[model samples]
Target: MTIVLAAAAAALFGCGTFLLLQRQLTRVLVGLALLSHGANLVIILAAGGRGAPTFVGGDEDRALLDPLPQAFVLTAIVITFGVTSFLLALAYRSWLLTGDDEVQDDVEDRLIVTRWSVSEELIDAEEAALAAHAEDVARREMDEEAHR
Candidate 1:
């Protein structure tokens, strides 16, 4: 049973990692789901296979299944569900924003670079205009002073 659990864990981990490395956002979300399931399984296995439910008034000597792991798994499932929902929403928003499905950090990076270049150009243009205006004003002041 331990060997089987270990194999299962390894398989889940490998698949999850593979999916996460994919460029598609959906694949990454799926990978996270797989990883969560793998973690839940690991926790349960660590507590031993589901044997019997825990009871307050039951026989104390009987090997009761660990309720802690079950509780933990339930909590984890809820948390994972919330995260999955959020990821889906984010994916949809990204699609709306970019009209592309595959995850693309590179596109965003390029856009940032382009925007920065435009901003720099605007700043340079404004500075040059301000300097030119200042020079004109200084020349007029000098002419007025000479006449006085």
Candidate 2:
């Protein structure tokens, strides 16, 4: 059959790209289920093989087979089995909250190493102490409008 379904979709995309470059998390959830069964064996070898068997009324000369790639590999295996059960429940809630499953480290590298140096130096010392208390309340309201 198309060279044994193109060598079983190149050995399921080379063992799902070597278990998605393993670091664990159950070999990246078995390399996303072997790259979703090598993209449903390349959408059933682009839908075509084992032909012969389809007839609509008065056997209008048989030879059918194209049930739209078996209904698009049964709706892409029920949406990749609900996205592999939501990526194994977010890798079991990231191994129960960070006991380790790897991943983190890039929310803009933890917002540039733990929030730009202590919240930008306490927001520039509270905007230079509110601009020196607004220039001492505008020089005491221009010395009470030059003494009345």
Candidate 3:
């Protein structure tokens, strides 16, 4: 049934997203696979109920099934397989080099975050100094008026 297929696709997508968020490369690869499968299911579902094959019959009364979704799914499958293979190779290489498939934080990213935090602190300090200076100026102006 359409409902069952939709549910399965939803489950696949949910699981895939969860796995994709993991730091482990292997899990990410599996997640990518699941996501692709879910996408394929969605394409099929969008194609609607099956009818006679587009080229199979000469009868004008029978509706012909649209082949576009099927073609798209096939292309997607090939692309996904290629990407999966590449990821597998990368994961294997990572495991060989580091003895684990877990992805580590990039030094560049950490540096950027550190710099951003420092910049924020500096901005806050500058704003506070400016506010204090403004108050001092206001107080001086009031004192001058009172003396006059």
Candidate 4:
């Protein structure tokens, strides 16, 4: 049973993440919803081992299901619902504004990527300089502490 639930959760999260990486807004919304479903399943699986309901009054020795996970799942469901609705509203607005449902890559991001060319040697030099600066600061701090 645990294995089955784990597999299902994994499938949901995998599908959700795959969908999320697409360029369409609708797919992203659906992906978020799927992710929420995966989270709910995880919460259920973590809620506790199968046992008697927590409401039972007199089964002192019997294991009872914990209620915290249930509460958390419920709250998460409400939050996810709100987020989905907001995303739908945004999609609707975007359609009104641009008549397109697909999201385009940001112009700034593309431009920056095209313009920047950092060599491996440059990165190594920057790291070495930063490390030396950090070491100098540490040494000065230690000297100050010794004097005090």
Specify the highest-lDDT model's number. 3
lDDT of 1 at 107: 37
Taking the tens digit of each residue's C-alpha lDDT, what string does model 1 give over 101-133?
A: 687655345545566567777656656766786
Models 1 onward score TM values of 0.64, 0.40, 0.69, 0.70
- Which window of ten consecutive residues has the lowest lDDT sum in model 4? 107-116
Model 4 lDDT tens row, 31-111: 989999999999989876665577675275766788888899999999999989999999898888779878966644544
Better of 3 and 4 by lDDT: 3
> Global lDDT of each model?
0.80, 0.75, 0.86, 0.83
| Candidate 4's TM-score | 0.70
Q: Which candidate gets the maximum TM-score versus the true structure?
A: 4
Model 3 C-alpha lDDT versus the unseen true structure? 0.86
Tens-digit per-residue lDDT, 1-148, candidate 2? 8888889888988898888888767787788788888788888777656555644532556556566876888898899889888877888899897787876555334445655567787656656665676887899899999988
RMSD of each: 13.6, 16.5, 16.3, 13.5
